[model samples]
Target: MERLTIDDMKSIELEIMDEIDRVCQAHGVQYFLGYGSLLGAVRHGGFIPWDDDMGIIMMRDQYELLMANFNEWRTTERFKLVSYRDKSSIYQFAKIVDTTTVIFENFVGKKAATGVWVDVFPLEHFSEQQGPALLKQHQRTGLLRSFAVADPSVGTNAFVKLVKRIVCPFVKNKDLYELAERLDRIALRMNAADSASTLVIDVLGEGKLEKMFSKDLLEPIRIPFEDREYFAPSGFEEYLSIQYGDWRTPPAENARPVHVMEAYRL
Candidate 1:
């Protein structure tokens, strides 16, 4: 079996993203290329030379509709949708995975099953006035996101793995998602149009910049990516600034993003 190189993985992810674009467009579901994916569109017009991951953000109702009618919208046999609702999933967000390939990841002392995929996230909202509470919530979200992974052998080092084995075992798999659902209830708002600002997945972002923007910039705009146009946040300049300050400038070689994962044909 031949290993899937970075280029190979990128090709798969792009195809999956394109499918997502098609499905959302056909159904009139609005979404925005998010996090590093959005940054790539704004800065590079494609994958950021070193980044392999893809992510998109949708408003509350839009995501619910897509998930509810996922099967009907999914036109390709190569893709399968999974979310925290699934027993094997650790993420609170949804993913559209390429069924014919697999990806094995080990990073920052964690390991889990993923695949050639594009991440789908809801546009989360909170009251800007509640600064202390929002900070604490994000800290909790990042912690729970890790715990949701539920991998017993979750570390690259012996000491970390030993500690994780002791901790991750205590939480029952079903209980993890239950906790996530509880956090979902804590969401103060969901509709982007009504929100003062919007945030995507915190743990999955590049920097801890703010997603808050005046509602005007919340509308979607078309931008070039991979020689094609895709929808990005209308306040994209501010959006990118929130995710990555000075995002227009490319990072130095050593500072560029890197993913410690491998993909292969299954």
Candidate 2:
């Protein structure tokens, strides 16, 4: 089989997004292009030239609805939705994967399976006090994730790395699955639907809080992405500003995607 090029990857990603969009529309679940995917939509009207993957986010309630209905709604012949709830999944977030294609990233370590995939992040509610609480929860999640992956380098510091290295030998895959469940429970316990702000937990990294958006700001609005339209927060400008100051300005060439990936149709 021939290796997939950048365009091939983009084509598969777009197909996944279309599937997601269809399911969301059918069920009234709102979603938005997130992180680099959102930046690409706004700044370039499509995928960033150097980007290889896609990310989309939904609020917690809507996310739950999707999870409840995903198996029935998904393009099962072509795609599979994997979440932390799945024993085979290690990541905290969910993924919509194209089974016919494979793409691998170096940072994720060993591969249980390979496929073209888009990340599905859930935006959880948070109050001011919840920051510290969420921080603690994420710290625990980070430690468990490190052990689960058996990667000491996941932590930013030497001490945490040392601890991970020491403990990983004793950790098993089942323990990792349990940790993921705990992390999910923590997120649910801390959800602040009555609060004015929300955050996407564990999307950027463990314990890294996303920008807080007011409830009104989160109301969905249509935005042009590629040749189609998709939902984004009404306060997209504010959200983008907080996440990337002067998001309009292109970064230096050398600062672009540093890692390269290979994808292939199976």
Candidate 3:
């Protein structure tokens, strides 16, 4: 097997995005390019030069609709949608994976394996009053996630390393998987439509509570992405400004980091 180069990774990601676009359009399910993927679309017109992944988000309703019809809509021979409901899937979120390729990341452990993929996030409704409860739930989920993956090499600092070493011995992978299911339920319950704010609950590791935005911001608008156009939040500028102040400016080369993953074309 040969490792994929940056160009190869980008090519595969574009394929995944195209398929997602096709399914969402056919079903009238709205989705928006988000996070770093949005940043790249607006600034670089594609994946950021150093970015290796893509992300798209849909509101809870659209997300659920997509999941309900996923098997019928998805190209089974080419891609598969993996979500928390799948026993081998570790993340609470969903991923659209290319079946004829392989992309392995250490954080996913052994049970789950998928090829080059794009992350599909659900924007959960949230409210200011729910902050404390959300934080507590996130903490528990975060701990379970860490235990499930349990890579001692993850941290560089002594304090972080020591904490992982201490906790690693006590948590079993099976227990972690079971706890993740409970966390998923809690997350689903928190997504009340009456709330004024919204968050991507599966992105808890990114301090998502602070990343929350007004539900009004979710109204979709089309924007250019790579040579094609895709939807983004109508208030994307406001959302981006909050998540990354002065998002128009490119980061320093050294500051532009991509997650570590090994990819190969089948």
- Name the runs in model 2 displaced over 4 angstroms: 112-114, 150-174, 192-206
Q: Regarding TM-score, does 1 or 2 come out ahead? A: 2
Q: Tens digit of lDDT per residue, candidate 3, span 52-154?
A: 9999888777878887787679865587787667553666667888878887775445455677888888777664566557667777677767765666545
Report, for every candidate in turn, its global Cα lDDT versus the true structure. 0.69, 0.72, 0.74
User: Judged by TM-score, which candidate is best?
Assistant: 3
lDDT of 2 by residue, 1-61 (tens): 6788888889889998889998889878888888788989888998898888899877777
Q: Which residue pairs in candidate 2 collide?
A: none
Per-candidate RMSD, Å: 3.8, 3.5, 2.5
What is candidate 3's CA lDDT for residue 249? 93
lDDT of 1 by residue, 30-147 (tens): 9889888998887788888889888887766687888777766799878878765664455556788988887777542233466688888765544445543644665676566565
TM-score of 2: 0.84
* Model 1 per-residue lDDT at 163: 73
Using lDDT as the measure, what is the rank order of every candidate, best first?
3, 2, 1
